[model samples]
Target: MRLQLNSSSHTPLYLQLEAALRERLASGEWRSGQALPPERELAQQLGVSRITLRRALERLEDEGLLIRRQGSGTYVSQRVEQTLTALTGFSQDMAARGLRASSRWLQRGIFRATPEEALAFGLSPTAEVSRLERLRLTEDEPMALELAALPVRYLPDPQAVGDSLYAYLDLHGLRPVRALQRLRAVAALPRVAELLAIRPGDPVLYIERLSYLPDGSVLEFTRSHYRGDRYDFVAELKGGK
Candidate 1:
């Protein structure tokens, strides 16, 4: 599609182009992960100099609406912003944003708990746990890789879980009341890169969470790797008086 800049408008040329590009993205004219035309080609098509085009594109990149890979052209971003203050499951999170959440199951079964797992659950070493591993997706686009473990008593049938583990737990009255989460940045491994459709060594957000029941016992232990480019975690802060 050709984009025409209003030459007589008071807005800067690059800003006009930026707004046009944003409109296209919002209209779904350019879908996520779809590569934009080459810089030269797009500049010529928009009747603007390469410098103006680059400036506009740079703004979009900063806004997380575009991604430019080294040696690869720019592509539309599939980024989503999430607030850190909420205690919600993946499904609920996506739903709040009007996105459909789905999962590609990797593993779901009962297994002997490791020493660390046993300690986390305050259970005996001989105790078993249920493990659920899956690729979390939205609109068929992979978003995160998750591995969750729970005491077998809480999730006796791992297969019983559907799209949302929290929902399943709620149904059984095993939902966690609160959680402690830690997040760090890490390079994506080859396996993770392939699954998330990103390059190896790309930045990823590694998060570990321990969810607690009302009695203060650990109910779930989960580790997840979120696509750094696709996730913007926000936190609201209040200043002290």
Candidate 2:
């Protein structure tokens, strides 16, 4: 594989490396569990500093897209396990792990839906939606700030919804059978930093998840801000295919 760097591009050299490698992965040039060239070799081949190459690889590893072994080498990460199966609620997952989970509800009100909200929940933009904003905790440690909006027509009383949105769905038989989630790394904002008790500019996980019921009805549109230092995406995978 050939890696190119543009010294003139304002983007950092490490980020450039990340982009090149990600492109290779996306194009199927590198398959899962495939070993990457050694840091020194790749650095020399790309005419860049070893430090830059190492930093790039480390970033990918942190993202769970690569696996590094001490004294061995680095390789592309295998896909996460059980990603295609199971739809468990956060509260239930935490409880199953012997951890206590709770939420500090911030806002509970029915508000006019925005265009984005309407599209996400399959409702009219002028329709009302139940908005929920809360800080979540596990073992008394702040983990995530969850902001969710549900169609008010489906849930009449905002006060009735509690910490576990899934519980409310289950009671009404609207539990989601599947969901689509997107995650990105972002800097913590002032208000979110204050709530998570972290400094501004600290790394945070931005997750947007849209869940739907078995009948294909949109149940919830949630955006959660998770502390990068405290939360991780864990997956288990099988190899034999």
Candidate 3:
């Protein structure tokens, strides 16, 4: 549907256009990551000058509702702000924000631990480990690619896991009480970009996490690649006493 600008209102044309576009996003008329019509085409459709439409688009971009790629045009941003202070599962986080969380499994099973996985899990090279690899989704949109490894004793049946690995661990009394995480910015590789629906070389957040059980045993070693455009990691700081 074409968005109509209200000329009779006291509001500025650009502001009116911005509000209408925001409504379209809020109402799901424009889905997350969906490209917007070309500037000229959209301006014509809205019966507004290019300048007015540009101004409105700029406003939305500033507010993190739109992303403007140099050669790819504008797309609706699927921005989800996550707090760094929380030790929560993906499903729990999405539930807090009233978004449905789901997963598309890429790999799941017990396998002999690779050298790196063996070192991470403190297991022998021949020891088996349960691996769960999946694409995390929120509101049916792909959000992150996660690969997690744990000792087979803790996760004996990878197929028993569901939407949330943390939840599954909790039920088995193996959930982590604390975690150490390292996050870095990396360019997406072709395979990751394909699964994430972004172009290769786009920025992505790479995270490595080591979650510990209450007794300080490592419970999980997880590596994740999150779409940079979709996630904002917020950290809170307070002054020392």
Top model number, TM-score: 1
Residue ranges of candidate 3 with Cα displaced over 4 Å: 1-75
Against the true structure, what is each candidate's TM-score? 0.75, 0.63, 0.75
Q: For residues 70-153, what per-residue lDDT tens digits would candidate 1 score against the true structure?
A: 898999987788888988899999999888889999999999888878888888989999999999998787899999999887
Using lDDT as the measure, which candidate wins?
A: 1
TM-score of 3: 0.75
Clashing pairs for model 1 are none
lDDT by residue (1-241, candidate 2, tens digit) is 5566888999999999988877777687777667888888978877788888888888887775776777879977544221324677778867766678899999999999889898897787588899999998876657789999988877789899877888988999787889988889999999999998677888998989888878898888999998886666765777996
How much RMSD separates candidate 3 from the native structure? Answer: 6.6
Q: How close is each model in CA RMSD to the real structure?
A: 5.9, 10.8, 6.6
Selected candidate, larger TM-score, 2 vs 3: 3
Candidates' lDDT values, in order?
A: 0.90, 0.81, 0.88
Clash numbers, per candidate: 0, 2, 0
- Indicate the residue-level lDDT of 34 in model 2: 77
lDDT of 3 by residue, 9-29 (tens): 899999998998888899998
Off by over 4 Å in 2: 1-85, 237-241
